[model samples]
Target: MTQRSITVLPGDGIGPSIVAAAIKILDAAGCQFQYDYADAGLSALEKYGELLPQTTLDLIAKNKVALKGPLTTPIGGGFTSINVTLRKHFNLYANLRPVVSFAGTQSRFENIDIITIRENTEGMYSGAGQTRALDNSSAEAMSIITHEGAERISEFAYQLAVKEGRKKVTIVHKANILKSTSGLFLEVAREVALRYPQIETNEMIVDAVCMNLVMYPERFDIIVTTNLFGDIISDLCAGLIGGLGMAPGANIGKEVAIFEAVHGSAPDIAGQNIANPCSVILAAIQLLEHLNMQDQAELIRAAIKKTLAQGKTITQDLSGSASTTEFTDAIIANL
Candidate 1:
């Protein structure tokens, strides 16, 4: 068997601690891989003077897969976003985030198995915006959207639904108000819907979609939308299950994929060792599944599910009594 190569970018703060735990779990599971350490975010700027170095991009291009820890986008903005850059650079247009309710975790709803398929590239995130301040009282940011971007993402969503055995896909947009931009998004989605006859398709305005999500989350199986809407709704979906701490995400393209924790870097709790590693650990499971190590992925997921169902050693947010490493060890023991 050829060893799978992966670029590991453990950015500043709790990213290192959490990723360390995930690596330990992978090692114990005997996952064969070579990890190349790379730089991004604040740590990268401090060391290499660039948040996302060309070398880092080069490494990911070479490896074609990366397992990244949470990266803190700088406040004042040197780069737009390291995450966004990686996605666009590789044309990673599909951002998949699965929000499932764990057995033991505290959740508002039960049996919530929703997957948010976000259009990762293009839309307003493509740096297609103009900012102008007319005497500070009024400022405008013009967002642009294209049919090509919308159609590809919608098609990707439908194909994913078919592949994953999902029944329906809901296209969420804001076409009612943002007529031109979001209208085009909906038009493209409807165009794509024609091709996927077997899968049921629906469209919901972004606002209504949020309300429906809270009122009846089970109605949604796969939610696909533009970049900005997807960013908001994905987190909202996370809340229905628990919170961002428990969410895991993947940025995928034809050639490469990057698995990462969906939450941001918690600088305050950086070295406290109290941060949750489940998100990153689960992301590693996603990496395994992406590599076609289905058996290994199932083993890890089963161990996690079993551990959670037992309700013994969970993190603070999950309302249990265990440190980060302790929780990780519990999962490893169960495995």
Candidate 2:
């Protein structure tokens, strides 16, 4: 088979190390692919005077697939988040995050399986607008909503539920408060849900959804929500299965898909060899599945599960003493 190429953005801080570990595991799984490196995050700013360089965008355009690591965004002000920028630029409107319980992990939940499908490029993150009073006393940020955006995301969620054989899709929203904005979303989502009659659909206010998530998580199989709600709830779901250290994310569009670890760049731990690479490794598995490489994807998945269950060699976050490299090596050995 021909070797494929994928854009690799190591991102910032411990991003590089974890990304390398993910690549090594992929290699050990007998999956061959050429990695085309690109720069982003603060590191890219230092090199190219920008967080996202044209070259990096071009690389993704050329390869049509990318595997990214945790990228830190400026806290107060500076450049926009590269992750957000890339998603909007690529029109990647669906964000897929699956949170599942694994043995030997720190999560309290057991046998939990949920897929959070977030609207990737709209709502509060729609780049709508921001305005301040002339005296700087008051300010406002915009949350834009469109029928097209809501319809597509809802369709994607229902279709995904059918494809995965999921039983239900819970639509979380704040329609009672942000009536116009979230109302439009819920309205369109219900319309889309009508098409998938076999898949049960439920709706709830965002605040109430949060409460039930912790108390009755087993009631949910799939969650489809707007950008902001999805962002917050995805992390909450992550906490149910495990921390962000074990979560992986994917931004998908009609043209391309980019997979990433949902955690942040641990600048404090950069180069310390103590970061957990499982998140990125799982993202790599998603990448393989995207490419229709099911056999290789299953191999990597089994290897990761076996490695984690053994629990002898794991990163500190998992209550083990192994360094990042050692943890990766254990996964490779399982492979």
Q: Which candidate is the best by lDDT?
A: 2
What lDDT tens digits, residue by residue, belong to model 1 across residues 159-221? 989999999999898888889988998999999999999999989999999999999998999
Put down candidate 2 lDDT per residue, 1-335, tens digits, no spaces. 77899999998989999999999988888888999999998888899888899999999999999999888888756456778889999999999999888787867888889899999999988753343344657656678889999999999999999888999999989999999999999999999999999999999999998999899999989999999899998899889976877889999999989999878898888889999899999999999999999999999888888888998998888788899999999988888
Superposition TM-score, candidate 2 onto the true structure: 0.97
Clashes of each: 0, 0
TM-score of each: 0.96, 0.97
lDDT of 1: 0.87
How much does candidate 1 score in TM-score? 0.96
Highest-TM-score candidate = 2
